[model samples]
Target chain A: MEFRGGWDRCCGEARSCRMLNLGHGGVRRLSTVDFPQTTEDLSLLYKYFAANQAALTRNMKKNKQLLEEIHVDLDIQEHLKMQEGARRFQQVGLFCILLFVGSAAFGLYGNGVVSKKHLTKDEINIHFERFFRFQAKMGLQIQATNDRDISISFPIQYLNHFEISSIVPEPTETRVEGSQVKYAFKGRDELTATFYLVPQQIGQIKGSVNVNENTFSISHFIFP
Target chain B: MNPVLRGIAVYLFVYVIFRILGKRSLAEITTFDFVLLLIISETTTNALVGEDFSLTVCFIMVCTLVGVDYIFSVLKTKSIWFQVASEGAPLVLVDDGKPLLKRMQQSKVDEEDVMEAARLTQGLRHMTEIKYAVLERDGSISIIPKEKK
Candidate 1:
């Protein structure tokens, strides 16, 4: 019988409530002894059923074990295989949910996939949310090496993709040099400048922090 | 949060959840099933809309939802395995007026449930009145009445 589930209705027209399945392959024949309903026969039926219970249970168990053998379950090897498949698919779906939540849940990962790198030259320890969602506020920390004047220039790509929401310890001078936005901090020792950045666009955004001659390139993916 | 992605996510998540819940869940066998469905719909609506109330977001959400559904339909047609995996096959619950107790138990169905369906579908008042009862993939019991004398 060509039985259609709720989902199967989508691909084709609605089926009429008539079954025309003749000699369906999944059918299994069973033979059972019928008992009479007379009071004396009923008492005898009870005794007979009690005696047959163990054999009945054994037959059912054997059928279950045979179905569990996988390859031997015949064409329609019982619905157990299908249930197993559905369970496996559910596990996969759950895994996807776990990954999605793990990578993007707000504050769950504490600023989201933080990347801390200590530059050898400028001693600029850049700690930032390397992975974040679109429009989500991400923290970017940059520390200067020793007590010296430093100018951090954000590349054009960064300016285009991310909007600088706020800056800590105001830069002495901020200027737009061509495509890059430059923030200059003069006469500062042991300075850690934090940039509160919000991604304006989604997907992987390539950017660079130019500290004098040293350029620290950063790539972050913003989920939509 | 983009409503388009959120819409798609909500749709797929609900679909998978419903699949895992099994076809019987769709029957909403009890009054409380409706309350559970309402709660789920409420959460999904919030997730799909978020803080965005713009018409553009609404349009994107609708399009994404419809598009994903279309894609799934196409996949189902293209792949038989996808069809079977998603919808499952029908199971025989009763043969020749005798209840297949093992199959019925595995499917979470009882003789009362099958007889209820039989009465509704074929006016079959007893197990002997039914020739065959199959638990269709959609979770509905289809009963075939025995040949009239």
Candidate 2:
């Protein structure tokens, strides 16, 4: 028997195929010249995919119950395959949900990134997002055991990338020492500095942050 | 902040969140769901457009979002696994007039939700009237009546 459907010929026979219009622009073929005499004919002739646009959505159940004894293996096989895939996706989705929550909590992109470092009875901490869009604001703080003198140095590359927006408890002296700039705050025990950085370049930007006699490295990957 | 990057990040983040939330998120939304969606969009606008109120900046943002979506669509068509990965597979929620309680509870769908769709679409009165109820990948409940008219 010849089929009239759209596009590709599913029966693989050389005949004029035009679809009866099922769903998703697929061609559904029906033979009116000869009624479906066998179960095979019925299986190939009658198959429908109903799209649900309800407020409450659910998965497509393979409803072979319409022709129970006939057992049309048409939509069921594909839907069942999809059903299996749908079932498996939940597990993958759950894992990704945990990952998303974890990423945000750790402050990779969303929030919560305040890292602290200590050296020589003095400690410095910065509130920074590990992964941030280019030109995002970040802050730096330093607490010293002795309030005698604190000199925070930033490398020339760091200076080039980040525009220092503001410095709180203004530094007594600011000078370019060697390859880095030193901002000295005399006798200031606790100091906080803010950088309203407009990134001139993207990708991994890493540099040494020298605080007084000690040095530590800070690195950040900026996204475009 | 980079508007294009911001747009891509927001799109991917929202897509993943909705995927985890389930098909109901993409379905014909309820009143509260639509409200929440509006709030989310409003909040996202600031992050996406930022202080750069220029037209070109907003254009770049829109381009980035649309470009990412088109790329995903291409991938979905090219790869079956990608199709399933991006847009999840359809699931069968009911069989032979019996509600699959485990799957229903897991998906946060109750009998009433199914009945609501059935009533609206198939004019179905009761659970017994439904031959099969399938939850489509796009957050739609496709119901098949036991007695087809």
Candidate 3:
């Protein structure tokens, strides 16, 4: 007999082929049908299959427990992977924050926010510098050790724009050399010379006095 | 300007900006968020230092900032009002498998976030399986699954 039209053709001459061709959906339909089968039919089918009801139930329970165990294990592994990723991210974030804070602190320190230079009196005396705005009186103290009168020359390189007609404590001799005034004076022993400067422009004044090849320079600023 | 005063002003200004932007602004980090954070820091650095370049000033500023932060933390711990003002209270977004739509909308938390939490914690596949969802103060969603029948 040819078994072809679903369950109606089962148990026919083609029963074995039909059973093999019945896929998962067909098997599920077959189970639903068997659920309402008569007791005699169930017993006959169980006998034909040669399986005890107790053994089938035990095997089914065992498979279900195994599946649940696998699911739980997979879930735990996934959770652990997520936690590991999160922990790595946290570590990287913490490292970045620390690096940023360190960079900021270093930047502040490098900008001179914490330390400053403290110069000594000798250094300042050697430099002999003063800053002034507009006109101001400036004095240069020169100490002479020998009794011989020493001639000194001060190069007025920064007072070109100033009114030289109003200079105080006039120099003994003033000579012009390439837009610069060379003020000469004679000093014996200790001497202090005072000069008055009136600025007519907005800029800086950097002048120097040459005494026997030793140069003493002074810097001043004129504000607008 | 004094370093301590400048530091305090900058700290307060940044604090106010973050507070106005709300807590969710920092809950998740995107590329844009990272760039924005860098820009904010660069601007703050310029404002804090101006033209001054002294190591002592920087040290004083850092000290003042730490002191202010410590004082705020102490105050927050001592006073409930300060705590509430600084850190918001936890909000309930779901109760007994029903979504509190208004609360969810206000908190910017949608149903998907709650469902994701349920799935992560309880292997749940549907929103109906969750009994409660709370938006905690730390910006995380806490889920409670419905009892199994």
> What are the RMSD figures for all models against the true structure?
11.5, 11.7, 21.7
The C-alpha stretches of model 3 lying farther than 4 A from their native spots are A1-224, B120-122
Query: Stretches of candidate 2 above 4 Å error?
Result: A1-78, A106-114, A122-134, A145-150, A188-204, A214-224, B1-6, B28-32, B70-85, B88-92, B101-108
Interface RMSD of each: 8.8, 11.4, 18.3
Of candidate 1 chain A, the 10-residue stretch with the lowest lDDT total is A9-18
Writing each residue's lDDT as its tens digit, candidate 1 over A130-213 gives 567677677788877646678889977677887788999889999999988899887466778889888888777887888766
Evaluate residue B39 in candidate 2 and report its C-alpha lDDT on the 0 to 100 scale.
Answer: 99
Q: Report the TM-score of candidate 2, chain B only.
A: 0.90
Weakest lDDT window of 10 consecutive positions for candidate 2 chain A = A64-73
**Share of reference contacts found in each model:** 0.20, 0.11, 0.00
Worst 10 residues of 2 chain B by lDDT: B89-98
With candidate 2 superimposed using the best TM-score fit, by how many Å does residue A35's alpha carbon deviate from the native? 28
Per-residue lDDT, model 3, residue A192, is 39
CA shift at B25, candidate 1, in angstroms? 5.7
Give candidate 3's error at residue A74 in angstroms.
31
Give the DockQ-based CAPRI class for model 2: incorrect
C-alpha DockQ for predicted model 1: 0.19
